[model samples]
Target: MACSVATHNTKSNPPVTTTGSDSDSGINGNTNNTNRLNELKFDVFESITNFAGNFDLDPDQNFYKNCTNLSNYFLCDQFACKFKTVDTQKSFSSIHFNARSLVKNLDAIMEFIETLHFQFDIIGISETWCNENSPPLNIPNYTLLSKNRNGRVGGGVALYVSNLRSYTQRNDISLTNISCDSIFIEINQNHGKNIIVGVAYKPPDVNSNHFVDDFDKILTTIDKENKLNYIMGDFNLDLLRYTSINSTQDFLNILYSNFYLPLINRPTRITSNTATLIDNIITNSHDLPVTSGILYCDISDHLPIFQITSFINDSFQNDVPIQSYRLINPLNIENFKQDLATNGWDDAQMS
Candidate 1:
C-alpha cells in the first residue's frame, strides 16, 4: 500500500472534466510532464542569471539513481537510469486523495503526478462525485472501480488500479452504517500475497455514533479474513484531537483494539486558523514492514498520504562470522596420530 494524498477544498469551483488521452500512461506521463516542467523552470531561472550557455542537463545524472530502476527512464536515449545489481523486490504503490470530484480536476491530478513524478500501482480517490450515469474515466493503464453516492453530488469513492496486476472489488463489507462513500479492492500481488485496500469518505454531517458502529462492523468483517489490510481516505475526524471529540476518541479506541496503526502523524488539512489531520492510512500487518508519510500538495484541501507495502525477501540467510581458530577433539587424537602415521611425508623426506 504505497499511498499519496493531495489537498482540495470541498467548496471550490465545480471541477471541469479533463478526459485522459490514449497516450496517458500514468507513470510515463508523469515522467514526461516532469521533464517538461523542469525544462521550463530551467529556461526561466537560466534567463534570470543571464547565463547564455546551453543547459544540457542529463536526466540520468540529475535524477536519484536509487529512486527507481533504470528501465523506467528508457525514453532518455542511451542515458537509461543506472541501477545497482541487487535483489529485485516487489512492492505495491498507491495514492489516496479527497478528489472532491474526479471529472472536475482529472487534468490537474495528472499534472500533479507529473510534477512530482509519483509512481503508483493504485490510486484511492474520495469525494469523486461520479455516479452510475457518468462517463467512464479512460486512464490508459488502470481500471477504475468506484462506489458512487446515490442521490448526492459531493460524495463518492474510487480505486484506480494499474492493469499490471489482477484485482477484484470486495463487496462483502456493508457500508450502510458508515455514512460515507467507500470502496474495497483485493489486489492479487504477483508475488503470491493478497492485499485488501479499503477507502472511505465520511461526511461531517453524519452521526458519529452511527459511523463508529458501522465502521466497527466493517473492521470486524475484514479482520475475520486475516489478509493484509490497508484502509485509507478522508474520515473527516481530526485524529490529532481525541479529547476534543468523543467520536475521534471512539474511532481511535476501535483501531487500537484491533491493532490497527495510523501512519500519518502530521496535519493533512490546514487553513488560516486551523491545521487538522483528517486523512489517514491504517494497517495491521506487523510482519510486513510498511513505510508511510504525508505529501504536501494542493490537489485537494487535505494533504495526500503516501504509504508503501514492500515485500521482504525470505530467500537469503544472513551470514554469521566465524572464528579464525579451531579446537581439536581429545578423543580423536589417537585416530589423528594413526592417520598421520600413514602419510608419505616421512618417505618423501627420506627420499
Candidate 2:
C-alpha cells in the first residue's frame, strides 16, 4: 500500500465562537472557550515590530478592544505585541506523506492543505502509484515533479514544489542504476544557499541491502554536491527498530556517516497492534534550526510528517548592525552631560 501526504502552515488566529446568555450556554460556552484557548497556545508567534500601527493604543483600542472573549483577546494580543523583535531569517518548509494512491485521495489532500494556517514550500509524496499512462496530477500554485515506477504498479515518488520557488529537476541524480523509485529537484534560493530536495520510496519487498546500497549512492552524490539537502520518503525500514534490526541500524549508520540526520523520531504509521516509523525526512544541514514531527492525519494508514528549517543568511547576518550601548555609570552620565552642554547646536537647530 502507498501513503499520502499533506502540508501544514503556522496558524495565528483564534477560533471564533458565538456567545449566548441562555442558562444552558454556561457549560458549553466555557468548554468551547477552553478548547479555543488551547488551540491558540499552538499558534506560531511572529514578530510585530514592522506592523503598520501604533504600538501603544491602536492595537489595544481599535483592533482587540472588541475581542469577544479571553481566547480572542489573548490571540490578538499575542500576534500584535507578544514579539518585539523582527525575524530576518528565512525558512524552508516541507511536508511528506505516503499516499498509497494519490488519485483517489487528491480531494481530501487538497482540503487538508487548505485548512493549514501556513503553506509549505515543498510537498512530497511516496507511493503515488502513478505511471506514464496515469492521468496527470496537479496542485494549484505548485509544479509537480514525479518519478513513476515503470513496470511496477504500487511504488512511486513525487514532489510538488511551490511555483514561487525556482527549481530544476536533477535527472542525473535521479536516473540511477538501481531500482529505487525517487525524484530529485534543486531549489534555487536568491538570498541563501540552494537546497537539494529529493523524495524516494522503497517497497517492503525490496532487498534491504540492495536498497541501502542504491540509496547510499544517491546520498553520496548529493553529499558531494555539498549543498543543503533534504531527502524524504518512505524507506519501508522501521526506524523504531534501529537498535534491534540489523538493516535498520545499517540504514541509520549510512545516514549518520553521510552527515545526514533524520528529523522524525516518532512513528508515522500506527495500527491496533503495531507502530512504525518508516517514513522520514533526513537533512544534511545540521547547523540550521529545524522543527519536525508527525502530523495526526488519518487520510491513510501513514501519518504526514513535516519539517520547517530556518536558514540564516550569512550575508544578512553580516549586514545587521550590532547594537552597542554605553555603560550607564556615573562617569558615562557625567561625560554625556558635559558633551551635551559643550557640543555645537547648529545641526540640532537646523533639524
Candidate 3:
C-alpha cells in the first residue's frame, strides 16, 4: 500500500537510496558522502501490534565519528543522547516553514539546518511543490513522509522526520475533510504514550468556518483516543488582528476552548506591503513542555517557526525498562562459531 512501508533492521537488507543526483549533499568536497551514508545503514521493524527501529554505527573510527556527527547534525553528546539518563528531561527542537516551493529550496534548507549549531528532530513544510509525479528527495539521516495534493497543484504538506526516533503515519486519518493538504503521524515515545503530530496547509480562500469544523473533526477524533496533539503549519490566517468576533474567530475559538497554546506571536510572512502571522505551531498538552518563536532565516518569505519540547528517551536503548529483543539466526552458524573461536582469547583476557 502507498500508505506505509516498514522493515526490520537486518544484515541482509540492502542500503536505501534516493533516485536523483546527490549533487547537494550539504557537505563540501565530499563526493563520496552518499556512499558513506549508504554504508551507515539500518531498518525499522513493525509487528501487527507495535513498531520499532534500531541501527548500530560501523566500528571504523573515522567513519563512525563522521557519520555520527553528520547524522546528529553536529549536536553535542548531551543533546543527542539526553534520554540516557532517567528522571532527566531533555528538550527536543521542531521547526516549521512555508516553503512556497520545497523542491527549489531543499538545498538551502539543508544548508540552513547545518548552521543551526544544534539538533532538531522534526520539520513541517507547507506548499511543498511535490505532487504524485515528483521523484523522491534523498535527505541523509532524515525521512520525508509527505502528503501531496491529490487533485490540484501548488498545495501540499510534508514532515521531515529525523531517523533518530520511531514514527508511523496515521493512514486512518483522512486529509480530504478540508480544502488543503496535511500529513499526520504518531511518534512512539518508547513509553506507553504516543505523540500525535499534524502538519497542515490551509489555502487562504477556504472559508474559515468550514476549515474550523473540519479541523475540529480531526482533533476530536484524535482527542477521543486521549493522545497529545501538536499541530503546526501555514494556515494563512492573520492571527495578530484576531478579535472576539472576527471572520477567523471560530478557528481561534476552537483552539482556545481545546486548550491549544499558540506558540508564535510574531509575524511569519512579511511582504513589502504587509506583515502577517499566518504560520504557527499549537499544542493541547502542557506535559509535552514546549517553548517556541520565529527565526529570522532568509530561506523563504515566511520566517521559520521553531519549538523545543522535552521528551524522555525513545531510542533503541534496551536498559530503559522498555521491552526490546532481537533474535539472531545467523545464515552461517559454523562460520560464526569458527570466527568466535579463532579470536585471541587468552591474550585478550590477560590484557
Candidate 4:
C-alpha cells in the first residue's frame, strides 16, 4: 500500500536464522494496560494529538525538542529522516536493521542503522538469509519478527519496536510460494492497540498473488480477533500499477475486503539494489488520520518507509507516526486464475 516499484537488487551470502519470542518492558503484552490503548490514538474530535510519551521537562534548545515527548522517545537517531514536526535539533530515531544479510558486509546492517541516526518503532527489511537460532540480536529497546526462506539466498525480514513491549514473533514458512514472512504482536501502553507487524519478501519467481492471499489472511485473522493491526513488509509486486497476474485489482481485494487502508508516506525504493519501490506500510486506514503516504530515499538500495496518523489518546497514546513504511499487497485472484486458465501461462494463449 505504500511503496510501489523501483530498480535495485541487494544480495547476501548463505542463509541465516533469527528466532525466539520477544519480551520487552513498557510495551509487552499482558502488562494490564488494556484501559489505555485507545487513549493514545488519533481523534478528529481533538485538534491536538492524544499521544502519550516521555515529555522532556526541559527539551534541549535544539531542533529535537520538537520531536521528543514525555510519553515516548525516538526509535532511531538519524537526521535525514522526516519527522512529525515535533523535534528539530536532534534528528529522528529509528530501529536498526538485522546484523546479518546474505550479502553486503556482515556488519553492513548494523553499520547502516548507526550511521543514519534515527529512531524507529518498526523496520521491514529484505536481503537477509537468516537461519534458525541465529536471528539478528542484542538490539536495545526492541524485538524481532520474520520468515526466512529455506532454499533461497537473500530473503528474510525483521520487525523491531521501541516503547511498546513485544509479545511473540512468528514466521510464515511457506513452500508453495517464495516468501519469508515473519509476524509479531506487541502490546502498547498508550493507545492500547494490539499491533500486528509482518516482515515479508516475495521474489520474482514466487507467486505474487499467492503471497497476497497469505498477507490478506493475516489481516483477516487479526481483525477477527479484534486487534488493531499495522502491517509492514517487502511485497515484490507494485500496487500503483497492476501486473496481469498481480495487478491493482489484486491488491484492492485484500485491503478493501478487510476494510483496511494504505499507511501514509510509503517508500519509493525499498530494495537496496536499484531504485525500485517494492516496500510498504499498510493499516486499517479508517482508524488513522493525517498520515504520510510516502517518504524520502536513503543510503541502502531500498528506501525507508514511514507512516504518521492521528489516533485517540487513551491511557497511552505514543502518537508514533508510522513514519517509515515497507511496501507490501493484492486480491480478486479468481480473475487472475480465470485469465490464466482462459489464456495460457504466457500471453500467446490469450489471442
Q: State each model's C-alpha RMSD to the native.
A: 20.6, 18.0, 22.8, 18.1
Candidate 2 residues 90-116, lDDT tens each? Answer: 778888878889988777887777765
lDDT of each: 0.60, 0.65, 0.60, 0.42
Better by TM-score, candidate 2 or 1: 2
Tens-digit per-residue lDDT, 167-279, candidate 3: 88998875565468888888877554577888998887777677778877777788777666788999876665554326555666566555465666655565433455578
Once fitted onto the true fold, the runs of candidate 4 whose alpha carbons sit more than 4 angstroms away are 1-117, 132-137, 163-166, 170-179, 188-191, 243-246, 264-267, 270-276, 293-299, 310-351
| Model 2 weakest lDDT span, ten residues long | 41-50
Error of 4 at 202 (Å): 1.5
Model 4 residue 138 CA deviation (Å) reads 3.7
Clashes of each: 16, 8, 1, 124
Ranking by lDDT: 2, 1, 3, 4
Q: What is the Cα-based lDDT of residue 10 in candidate 1?
A: 42
Model 1 alpha-carbon miss at residue 287, Å = 2.6
lDDT, residue 270, candidate 1: 49
Q: Rank the candidates by TM-score, best first.
A: 2, 1, 3, 4
Best candidate per TM-score, number? 2
Using TM-score as the measure, name the better of candidate 3 and candidate 4. Answer: 3
Error of 2 at 9 (Å): 26
